[model samples]
Target: MWRAIFRKKLFIAIMTAQFMIFAFDTTTRADDVSIGFLYTIPTLMGFLIIERGLQITIVVLSITLILTGCFFPVPIETDLLVFFANRVLSIITVLITGIMVNYRVRMEQTLGDALAKERKASAMQRAFVSMVSHEFRTPLTIIDGEAYRMGKVKQAVSPEDLQTRVKSIRQAVSRMIVLIERILYTSRAFDNKISMHLERVNLWTLLKSIGRQHSEVALSHQIKVNVHDLPVSIRADRNLVTYILDNLIGNAIKYSPEGSVVEVTGQTNGTMAVIAVRDQGIGIPEADLPNLFEPYYRGGNVAGISGSGVGLYLVETFVRMHGGRILVESVEGQGSVFTVQMPVAGAEPAPAVSTGESSFPDKQ
Candidate 1:
């Protein structure tokens, strides 16, 4: 804010000085010379103005002022040819200076933008490395711990205990596989290498399958699916669609408290198929909403939650590939609802969905 105020003050000062020079040039007559050339000073100074349009306007105004000075009161002894020639020369000088200044400013802006992007990429790379290290270490530790426990047991292990240890090892390995797949998916998404094997898929059947799978893993959370209004079938990439749903549902379960409800609702809107995953979870902070889908960006409030932060990014990417969009609404400490809208197969593109007020009710 202070910088903006300073810029405004500087702009006013430059314009004021330019006008004063114009007034002096118009009022004074010096033999056969033109003082209009002094306008170049202000035209060059226009570099300080951040806006290219305003800078160009300054140049044009300077030319106009120089030309106007020619018709202003001057000595009768002043030669017309010399006066007109000098004014034209002054216009050319100011115009050239303005162009150079504008060009320089543009180059500076481009360089600044490039630098900003570089910085962001660097930061993301560091975060990705750190996250990968931590994510891999957790599963590896679990697998190692289970192995060490079985090896150190002095007595014969019971069948049930052996099964539990084996399950733990498998779960750890499965988690590692998931992490690998997510990383691979993100890479493919960035390279635009993800190919969709479009096929007619049973949407309702897929939802039930996903719900049952999540229910097995998150036994404490009640997973509910309502697809009464949803289209039974749609042409889509089954794998990508599954990825989208899996991520949303998994996140809903993972982020919410044990015993909380995770609801998956589906419906149709015009030419669109809408799916929403709502959860009674530790709601996202309002400030984090805008960056929620940015890769490696986790919510500020999810301190102890285990996450790689790529789930929502992949979700959004897959949805876009299917010609859909995702909308999210959350109130801190209440819950969140993520709505996915996709174009129905064999239909014209659906109209854009407005994310008006959130449907998630405020907690009493």
Candidate 2:
């Protein structure tokens, strides 16, 4: 409430109204220039309330000019020298007040901006810690279970059983490694340090590799690849493309039922390479769809699910880094589909991407 009173527009309006009130006070015995001292309020407001220095200077000068004209028409009761001196002193006071107010406002604005940025950084840090703790649990559990089973066998476990436990441990370790890498990448993204090194990449080969890895890591979910229409290659940052594909497929598996088939399709659309991932999962609500890719935002339906809500955020970031866009379509309790479009290799080199609102496809 107090801040609103100090806003430049409101402050200016109040000061102007006050000056008008003074101008109409017909019972005043003061000299005209003394009444014109009311102009000082606007000059002080221009410096203390407005953000643009040049604009405030113009407003103060206009107010001074108007007040001078109003005073010129009034007859002075004192000697001419005294009248001139008084007006000069009032003008000097206005200028000095304006200068001091401007300096104070500038310093306050700088301090406020710094404090706001610090608060935002602190919030990100808290989210990062929570995500790390949540995401590491599954892998750590897997490793712990495998270790426990091996210890229980007490040298009587078969060679095949030991090997199976070892493989599970390795898989768990791989998952932990990937989770850590994502945390690091997300931190860099917050700092806007994401750098892309584009190159010609084979689409078929990349999709196949991602499918194989998903199948190996998530044995319960199956990934189906459909790249019959995709070009052999496209210009992109190979690592970024892999990151995008990995997150989409991983999210599909994480959200879907066991044995559900997640479809990965790639094709060429105009000069762009389009990749779509569709899953038979509990879909997002209409309200949640808009916030799906927001950092640390999880859907209402995912209350019991194990997720940090960073996968889609990372996917969106990586796609934009390739100068691409992502689209999502979902119906609650039915399924969800995510489509990514990137400029194809040999087409015009894509411009650097910007952080903007995501667009969703119209539901059928």
Candidate 3:
């Protein structure tokens, strides 16, 4: 109950602060800036605790009243009303500021919790990937040595047996490489270390190329790969887009049952290109869907699936890097759709973006 009340107050206060900040301009400042300055000093000082905020507010406001006495020629009645109204405004602003500060603290605490969980999962994944690589690498090395040495043996090795073991080593190495790269890619994306090498590329052609790479995964699951229809062109970092799609399609196959459908759809809407990966895989929970794009956040139903949980994280980061948004629609136990919307280079948004108001002057 306490938390609920705090959140409601915080929301109202922050919104009000935002409204004031956006609305106040030097040209539009019908109210005196000194009054604005005095009113905000209290709220700023009062950010953390009601008691502390109120104390600082009072101190600052008192100083303002004293300073104005020396600088301005004011009548007694007008001065009284100004003091009364300013005091009321300061009280409201302080409460609002305290709420906003508290709400942010709560949000950060929640983010920390989620990050800690993800870190634990990543640690476990790192351990598993490490142990498996070490375990498999030893055997693979032995097999590879045996295969190479067999050719020099006085007794001839059956070409069939030699070929089989070599094939197994190759497969193991491929799996290890894939797991290692996925984790690494996720790390870079989360850290915002990915640098774009942007170029104008045909989206249809690109999808077709990436689609072919996943053909085997699709064939194994009896899922069709469709890239015949897509936006003809888009401007993006080609390699990043490829990585995004590869991870997305791989995950879809990894989660879906055999014979389930996996579809890739793309089209240009206004100034953005939307690429969606729709899968009839085990769906995500409604509650868990919001965190899907968070780094290392694995879905509840995907606990047993094969993933490092960085696919969607990298996907979202890459899309956002290009000035776009990603969205998801999923139903637990039904299926999931991951959508990537990328705005075209040099395109303007249709709607005017609105900013919030603050009592303080703009910092920049």
Best by TM-score: 1
Flag regions of model 1 displaced more than 4 Å.
1-77, 346-364
Which residue pairs does candidate 1 place in steric collision? Answer: none
- Which is the winner by TM-score between candidate 1 and candidate 2? 1
Query: Per-residue alpha-carbon lDDT of model 1 for 28-143, expressed as tens digits?
Result: 54343445655557646755564666655655665566566666776788777666666566556666776777788778989999999999999999998998998999899999
lDDT of 3: 0.63
Q: Give the CA lDDT, 0 to 100, for residue 258 in model 1.
A: 98
lDDT of 3 by residue, 92-171 (tens): 56556656777787688799999998988878577556545554565567667766776677876788977977777676
Ranking by TM-score: 1, 2, 3
Best model per lDDT: 1
Candidate 2: where are CA atoms >4 Å away? Answer: 1-31, 42-50, 60-95, 188-195, 212-231, 258-271, 280-301, 327-337, 345-364
Candidate no. 2 TM-score = 0.69
The Cα RMSD of model 3 versus the native structure comes to 12.4
| Residue 229 alpha-carbon offset, candidate 3, angstroms | 5.5
Model 2, range 1-364, lDDT digits (tens) per residue?
7787567567666665654443332113224565657656764665565556554555465556546555654454655555555555665675678678877878888999999989977886787788788778888999999877777764587888779888889878977877666677776776766666667899899899889888987898888998988988888766777778877888888888998989998888988888899999998999999988877778989987877667788888878767779999999888899999988853244454323322211111
